[model samples]
Structure formats: structure tokens, C-alpha cells
Target chain A: MSIFEIIGAVFLLIGSIFLFLGGLGIFRMPDVYNRLQAGTKATTLGGMSLILGVGFLMVETNWAWMVKAIIIVIFIAFSNPISSHALARAMYKRKRYPIITSKDENMDAYREVNENEKKEEDA
Target chain B: MRKFLVILILAVLGFYLFEAFSGLGLGFPRFEHGVKDYYLDKTVSELHVANTVTSIVVSFRGFDTLGEVTVLFLAVSALGSVLYKRRHDVGSRSILFASSGIVRSGSKLLFPAIILLGVYIFIHGHLTPGGGFQGGAIIATGFLLMLLAYENFRVSHHVLSYVESLAGIIFVVIGLLGFIDGGTFLQNFLPSGILNELFSGGVIGIIYVMVGFKVAAELTGLIYSVLHEKD
Candidate 1:
């Protein structure tokens, strides 16, 4: 293996490690929010890196592998976080809370809008 | 007593599963002689389909696929009937648009790309690992994202019905054409060109494309019914 292939193998190792940590994070995280955060973030990065490594390894034989890998990486980047975000929103709507939250959490603006809408409906 | 009975049941199931799977090797798919060899040999030679699974699904077992598509269509139709009653209730759909701007924008941006990818998968089904079912599901998911994130997002019932009916008719019509052209039902009557090309699998590719559209419409309609039932 040449320099690029060595780098690709290293990336593969890192990707696998991250993927393992992602699974561990899912198992160990305290609440839905924390689990979603850990699961989506780590898995997305891990999967992207792993696919990128495969692309690099196959670059010598066929350049198309890299293109496909990049497309997959982009897809994972776009989809993983969005899906987790949707899941977390659904959980929140269902009244599943995080372990703790400050009184003025960043999402209070959204809550305010929703509360106002409810008030309007009531009126 | 309950726990013991559950464990006993589980043990019996495990034993049966073990007995059933004992003949096959651990991981690798070994399609040896007999029927397996015949399909493998015939698919490449007569049909010129690169993916044997595609040939089997879209040609050899095309009738099974027709049945599967019919079942899906019936399920969607049933859902539409059940949900149709409450559709006019017109209660405010507050469950949607609860997401922030980031999610809404991201989903919107990804929708077209997701659809393009799904179309690509079904079109290339004969040559690739994925096929109509997987691709159609992916397309439905794209619509699902839009449906969940936006209040105004609506796939018209009329359009969905038209597409679904047309696709289903086309699939059956293709199968029927096989009788006229070839001796058997759903036979590869059309000339299968060189293998691995886009159009090499002849009617297999065409049928898969139709199945993709049919499934996409049905699943999208089903999701719409479940999501937008107002009462």
C-alpha cells in the first residue's frame, strides 16, 4: 500500500472506533436527547469517514468509487442529523424531557411561538 | 411460572431455528447446483440480466411481485377509505411545523435529491443491488419528510390515484404481453441486449420502473392518509 492507502487504512480504523463509540454512546446516554445527539453525530462522522476510506482504497482501480463515496457522505451528512432532529422533536412533543434543562433553554423561542398559537386558538 | 413458560417457548423456537438453519453455512451465500444453477445460468444467457435476483423477482417470479403490489395497493386503498371520513373535519394540524427553521430548510433542500436518488435506484434496478421496492420506499420517505415539516405540503389524491392505477395497469399489461409474444406468462419476450447495460434486462427493467412508481404512489398516499386525518 502507498501513502494514500495507508492514510485510507488509518481513516478506516478511526471510522470503526468512532462507530463503536457511537453504539456505546447510544447504550450509555442518559436520555433521548443525549442519545440522539451522540448517536447521530458519531455515526454520521464514522460512516462518512469509513466510506471515504473505501473510496480512497479503490481510487487506484476506479475513480467512480470516490464519487459514490462522496455522494454517500453528503447524504449521511444531510440525513442523519435531520432524522435525529425529527425524532427528538417528536419525543419532545410527546413530553419526553432531557435529564436537565436551564429555565431559558435555547428552544424557548419555539415554545413561546407555540404557546402564543395555543393562546390564539383559545381566544 | 409465566417466566418459565416464556423461556420454554423461547427455547423451543431457538431449537427449531437452529435445526432449520443447520444446513446452510454461517455467512456466505452459496447457490449450488439444481434450480439455483438453472436460474443463474439462464438469467445471464437468455435474459442477459446482470443481477440474478432482479431477473428472478421481475421475470421468473413476476406473478409473486404482482401479488405483492396488489396487496400494497389494497392496504393503501383501505387506509384511504378509513381516513376519508375524517378528512373533512379540518382540525388544525398543529403537530406539523413544530420544528425549527433549520430542520424545515434542511428537509426542503434534501427532498429533490432524495427523489432523484430513488429514481436512479429503480431505473438501475436490473444492474444494481437495489430494486423497485427499496427505491420506491426511499421516494415515499422524501415525501414523508416534506409532509411532516410543512403544513401546505399535500400530494393530491387524484394524482396519486392516477399514477398508482396507471403503473399497476402497465405492470399487468406487460405481463399479459408475454403470453402473446412468448409461450409462458411474464416471459422475457423482448430481446435482452448485452448484459450490464442500462436497457439489457428488457421487460425486467421496464417492469421494475413501473413497480417503483406504483409503490411510491401507494406509500405516499398511505402516509398522507395517516398523517392528515383531521378529526
Candidate 2:
């Protein structure tokens, strides 16, 4: 009934929708990299929205509870993406193939530069 | 046969729902009061931090937080040990990348801003709705951004472990202080000064700082375990 409650409900709804989108993206994306990008990004945003909604609701009723709810949202946002990046990097290092496009210039340059640097340091 | 089984299960679930909502009263029993009430009453005035929920987590329910932090620490350790062994066994070099200027440039620009925002969330946690865990995770994002921008970026191993251990030690020390003063771990042993001011909440700010450090250290370690390998 209250404006804050309405806003909270809308955020929760939007968050759920984003979560669903992330799930669909995971299934539908062409490759692991794309799927990670889609799923992780959406889930992070979705979770934040939902937690923020809960925080707002808590604030409306008990102002003291808002901080914790915010914490939950922030934690999710930070950890989810970092974990995703780690997984993505590991896959790349292990030579996992992406769905589309070949010719990875970045990887080649990185290897060359790193290897050269290592050799120099050793010498 | 599988389709039939699925339909049967759905039908049964629908029937159960129908029966319950039809006033048959087959739902689980509801408690009149909950554990939250006790926390709500005590935390509001005593914590002096606006967020009772945060107080419950880092103070009232600090034991659970300790376990969660330990779990993260354990995971990082497990990952590191396995990777260490694997790297020793296989001394192979393989390089791969996506030649996308757009993606690379975008990440370069976006990463620092995201990290700053994460720090903002943690620093203003007591006043606002965010806290340490969230903020630390954000700080980890900054590290992650660097990794994305440049693949060979290795976080200093010694620094990472020191930060992690230091955070763990701080957490324990705070808990021990609480035990010494209040006869309970994480109790508000210090004075709960005036409301709505930093240093007003006894031990709460200290707890948040600890949580932030611990979470940041653990997350950095986690990222390192998964991302970094001997080359």
C-alpha cells in the first residue's frame, strides 16, 4: 500500500526477471564465455535489485535492518563477478574454446610479452 | 514413460496445493513469534547502528559469520593446494585470447569505477545499508579488473596470505575481547554512545572493519586460487 512497499515489490519483481534472464542466457548462449558474461552479469544485477528491495522494506519498517540487507546485495554483486572471472580465466588458460570467433590476439601478445620478460629476468 | 511420470508428479503437486488452499489446513505449522524479535528489541538501542540486521550478523550471529569466513578460507586453501600440485605435474604453456578491442577497452574503463563504488558501499555501511562483506567483495572486483585488463598480472603471493591471516587474527581478537568483557563472544562490551554517529556503536564499527578485511582477503585468495597458476 505504501510507496516504499510498492517500490520494493517492483524491485523484487525486476530482480526475479533478471535472474530468469540469466538462467535462459546460460542455456541459450553459444559458448562458455558468452554464457558466463550473460549469466553472471544478470544474476549480479538481479540479486542486487532484490536485496535492495528488501533493504528498502526493512528501512520503511525498521530502519536498523536496512544495513544488513544492503550488505547482502553488495556481497553478492562483488563475489559473483570475481568468481566468474576466475572461472573464465582458468578456462582460457586451459585452452577452452569460445563459441564464436577465432584469432585471439590478446592471448598471443600476453604470452609473448610474459615469456620474454621471464627469460630476461632469468638471465 | 518419463513424460507420464512428470505429469503425474505435477498433478499430485497441484492436488496438494488445491487441498491446502481449500481450507483443508494441511500446510506446515506457523510459529507465533520468531528468533528475530529478540534481536530486534536488543539491537536497536544497544548497537546504536541503524542496521539491526547487520548487528545481528556481525555481532549477535558472529559465530555463523566466522564459519562462513572459514569456509571461504578453506575453499581457497583447497583450490590452492590442488592447483599447486597440478602446476608441478604439468609444465605446459598454452595461450588464448579474444581479439576484441571493444571488450578490452570497456573493461579497462569500467573496472576501477566499480571497485570505487564497492569501497563506497563498505565505508558508508553503518550509516547506509551496506557492510564489510559487500564492500570487500567490491574491492576484490578491482583486482579482478586488473586481471581482465592484463592477463599476466599476479597479485603478490606473500601480501595476499598476510592480508588473509591478518584479517583472520583480527576477527578472533575482537571475538576474544567480547568474551573477556561480556562473558560472551561478540557482545557489545564497549560503550554504546549516542545514536546516528560513527563511534557511537560499541564494537560494531570494529566488527565491520574486520568483516570487510576478512571478506576482501578471502575473496582475493579465492580469485587467486582459480585464476593464478605457475607458468
Candidate 3:
């Protein structure tokens, strides 16, 4: 095997490991927030790595494969975080809090903002 | 008497269905010298559309496309009617929970790219795998991203409806013009230029563009109508 193929195989191995870990993370995480965090971050990197490994292996055929892989990676970079954020925000809005509270008093700033909006409307 | 009549009608239908279906050999369809062959043969040479699928969809079986578009239009209208409220009856609509600034800015950043991708897909429909429906769905998804991420981002009903109606009308007008000229609905009346060029597919390309526009507008309108229903 060529050096590039070896490198690609190694990347694939790493990506597979990360993907397996990501699945495990989602399974093991206690709550929605932690699961979302584990799922998005790990899967994003795992998928990117897997795709990039494929891209490297496919370099002999055409550079277009590499370009597509990069594009998907970029899309993952954009969409993964956004979707996770939206879901977390939705969950937070629905009052599904983390199992343990952080020691921050301003964590519930939404309540204050909502109250302020109500007060302004009232005024 | 009614039960007997129903049984007779069903028996007749079953016989007809069985007769029609049994003629064709059941395995992998051997498309030997039939409509598929004719479509495949004529699409490139006669229609000058590289994509046989595009030619069939936009030229040969274009009435089906019109009917499909009409069905989509009806569905959108149904959804709108179902979720509609008088502007005065309801308070101003906004996302109950405002998404973060990251989402807002990120969506704003990605919106134009998504739109450009959709437009590119539809415009290149005659040359590529994607056509009106796929592109329009992509465009609608982009609008959906905007709808989900922002508070005040509402697609105007008036403008969307106008665009949708105009697109549908133009598509029909094109079909009528072709029929009047060539004695066939959606006939290739215009000069079918050399295949694989931008303007090669003539009326086919135009129809697909119109279909894309109509679908995008209808889907966006459908999503918009639903978005407000949360209140």
C-alpha cells in the first residue's frame, strides 16, 4: 500500500473510533443537553474525519471528491452546531433543565427578559 | 340489490386489472421497443435535451408536470386555508423563544448560499440530475432556516401568491403556445439547439424554471402559513 492509503486507513480508523465513542457518549449521557453536546461535537468531527479519509483515498480519481468532502465538512461545521443550539434552546424554553444546576444566578436570564418585555408592553 | 351491484362492479374492475397486468412479463422490465425506447431515442436527437429525464418531464410528459404542479398548488392552498387567521384577529407573530444571536447571524450568513445553490440546481436542471422540485424544496428549506432562526422574518403572502400564480400561468401559456403552433401539447416548437448548452432545451428549460419558481413560492408560502399557526 502507498503512504497516502496508509494515512487514509489510519484516518478512517480514528474516525470510526470517534464515531463509536460518539454513539456511546449519546447513550451514556444522562440528559438531553449533555447528549446533544456529545452527539453534535463527536459526530461532527467523526463524520468530517471519515469523509476526509475517503477524500484522500479518492484523490487519484479526481480532486472533485476532495472538494465535495470539504464542502460537506464545512456544512457539518455550520449545521451541526446550529441544530444542536436550536434543540438546546427549544428544550430550555420548554423548561427541561440540566439535572444539576450550575452555580450561576443569571442562568435564568430569560425570565428577567420576558418580564421586562411584559412590563414594556404593559407600559 | 345494492350489494350485488357493488360486487359486480368490483368483479369487472378486478378482471380488467388482471387482464391489463398479466400481459406484461413480471420480472425485471425488458423495455424492448416500447414508449421507453421511443422516449430514450427521441429525447436527445429531437428535443436536444441531454437529460432524457428532463426532456420527458418538461416536453414529452409535460401535462403530467402541469397536473403535478396544480396538485402542489392545491395542497399549499389547503394548508394555508387550514392554518389561516385574519391579520386583525391575531396579535403579531414571532418565535416564542428567540434563537441565539449565533443562529440568527449564522442563518443570515448561510441563507444566500442556500438560495444560490437552489437557483443553480434549477437553472441547470436540463443538464444535471436535479430539476424544479428538488431545487424548489432546497429553496423552501433555506426559507425554513430563516423562519426558524429569526423573529420578524415573515414571507409576505401577497408577493409569494403573485409569484406562484404568475409562474403557473406562464407554464400553461407556454404549453398552449406549443399546442397551438405544433398541434401537440408542449411540443418542441422552438429550435432545439445543440444539446448540453445553457439555452439548448428551449421551452423545456423555461418550463422547468417556471416550475422551480412556482414550487419555491408555494412551499415557502406553505411553511410560512404553518409558522404562524404556533400562536
Candidate 4:
């Protein structure tokens, strides 16, 4: 109806698209770690966009709802990455190695560390 | 033969469910003039509360809330008892695995803000959509984040238990006070302040605050016990 509403609708559409992409990534990704990265990043942005769109729509009527929306956006931004990181770390600790297609420097370093520990044990 | 029999049973059940559901309207529910009207009309004038849901939860259905809180308490206690272990039994297994500096710092930074948001939600329950349960869950989530990020973080058992007991006691004492004042249980004895204001809703707000504290403490304790399980 209004310009703000139109903008809100656009944001909502973009957010929905991102969310769908996130789901697709989860389905397509090879390993647990990759899937977590895709899902977390895409969904967090998607969700925040949706909330912002709703806040825009409510700007004309109620400002309080917009404030609440902002708070939610901040919360999601803060929490999502932390959760994904925890999951990734836990998986790594449990020896759930990723399927490596090419040379990965981090994996090489991790292997070297393990070898060093084994050598120390042998001594 | 087994597959055929299973398919026949599934078809029969699906048909029955479909037929039953098809009789009911699928769209928006029809508006009715029952207790809904009474609550909408009387909530403001009688209770001086803008939120009818709060009035209903804290006043009309106070006993139900109490029962729900009791069930939650019982569930938490049961979980704690089942997961209980002696100090030595909780072996010094390093719960904190090696984590990146980003995660460690991020959790510490966000923890206080999340707790503040939870407190805000519960305190404004009478005026807002969120109340004790929602706020408590959010607070518990913050604790969960800390547990996941920090290796040696522990929620003090004594503090949680004390807060839980104190909140429960205050809630009951308030209800008893109303009864003793020759009114119904959990009746609003104090003068209902101006509507739409924070201090309004009298006993309803107070009761909700107590519920919030109890829920937050109980949930945090439950999470702690579960996370600290002996390997």
C-alpha cells in the first residue's frame, strides 16, 4: 500500500529466499561442519531480514514493536555464530573429520599436532 | 501378506481421520460471545489491567499456574536426583575442550545482555506478549551458551535452590494473604494502580515476577545438572 510497506514486502521476500537457500545448502552440503556453516550464516541473515521487514511495516503504527524487533535481531546475531562454533568444535573433538577434496592448511596443521603428540607418547 | 495388512490398516485409519476432520471448518474460527466478551469488557475495569491474558493467568487461573509451576519444579528435582553424583564421581574430566578465542570472548560479552533481555521480558509481562515462561526459557538459553563456551563454568547449586524456594514461598504467601483478607485465593487485595502502567495489575504483576524468578532458577539448575553429568 505505502512505500514502507512495499519495502517491507521486498525484505520479506528476500529473507524467505535466503531461508530456502539455507535449507538447500543443508541438504546439499557434504559434511556436518559445512552444513552447519551454511545453515547458520544463511538462516541468521534471513531471520534478521524478516524481523527488520516486519519492524518496517510496524513503524507507522507502533514503535515499540520495532524496538522489540531490533532486540531480536541483535540477539540472533550474537547467538547464532556462537552456537554453530560450539557444534563445529564438538564435532571436531569427537573425530568427525570433514571430507577433504583439496589441501587444507588447517587440517595439515592439526595432523602435525597429532603426530607430535604421538611421538611424545612413544618417547 | 504382512505388507498388505499394514497398508489396509493405514488406509482405514487415514480415511477415518480425513472424514472426521472434513466435517469441521478449516478456515478462521467463528467468533463467539462467551467468556471472551466478559474478559474483554471486565478485565480493565475490574482488574485495572490492560492485558486480559495477564489478568486471566494471574488472577482467574492463578491456581492452574501454581499447578504448572509445581509440575515444573517436580520435573527439575527428579532430573537433578537422577543425575546426581558425588564430588569424586564427577571426575575431573576437562569439560572445556580447546575452543577459539572468538567463541570464548563472544559468549562472555553476550551473556549479560541476554540475561537483561530476559529480565525485561518478565518484568513487562503485564504489558507485553512475553511472560514468565518465555523469559525464563531465554535466560536458560543464555546459561546454555555459557556452559557450551566456558570449560569450568558452574552455576552455584545453593544460589539456584535458594532463589527457587524463595520465589515459590513468596507466591504462596501472597495467595494466602488474599485468602486471609476474606477474599478468594489470589484475589487482588491491593488497589489496582492506573491501567497500562508498569505498577498496575497489582497482584498479577507481582505473581508473574515471582513466577519468572522461580522458572529461571529452576531451568538454569536443571540445565546445569544435565550438563555436568559424570562421564
What lDDT tens digits, residue by residue, belong to model 3 across residues B1-231?
999999999999999999999987778767666798889888887888888898888877888999999999999988877777777777665545577888998898889989998999999999989999989999999999998888678788899999999999999999889889989878767887988998887798889999999999999988887777756
Local accuracy of candidate 1 as per-residue lDDT tens digits, A1-123: 787798789889989999999999999999988888889889988998999999988888898999999988888888788888879877866767666566657645656665677799899
DockQ comparison, 2 vs 4, better candidate:
4
lDDT of 1 by residue, B8-67 (tens): 999999999998899677877575555877889999999999999989998888899999
TM-score of each: 0.87, 0.59, 0.81, 0.85
**lDDT (10s digit) by residue, model 2, range A5-109:** 888889999999999999999999888888998889999999899888887766777976778787667667656766677677667656675653567667545
TM-score of chain A of each: 0.86, 0.80, 0.82, 0.84
Candidate whose TM-score is highest: 1
The C-alpha stretches of model 2 lying farther than 4 A from their native spots are A1-123, B1-30, B86-88, B94-108, B229-231
Q: Candidate 3, clashing residue pairs?
A: none
lDDT of 4 by residue, B45-101 (tens): 888887788778888789999999999999999997777777766776655565667
Tell me the whole-model lDDT of each prediction, alpha carbons only: 0.87, 0.76, 0.87, 0.86
Off by over 4 Å in 3: A101-123, B1-27, B30-34, B86-88, B91-95
The residue pairs that clash in candidate 1, if any, are: none
Winner by TM-score between candidate 4 and candidate 2? 4
The DockQ figures for the candidates are 0.64, 0.07, 0.55, 0.62
Q: Ignoring the other chain, what TM-score does chain B have in each prediction?
A: 0.89, 0.79, 0.84, 0.89
Is model 4 an incorrect, acceptable, medium or high docking prediction? medium
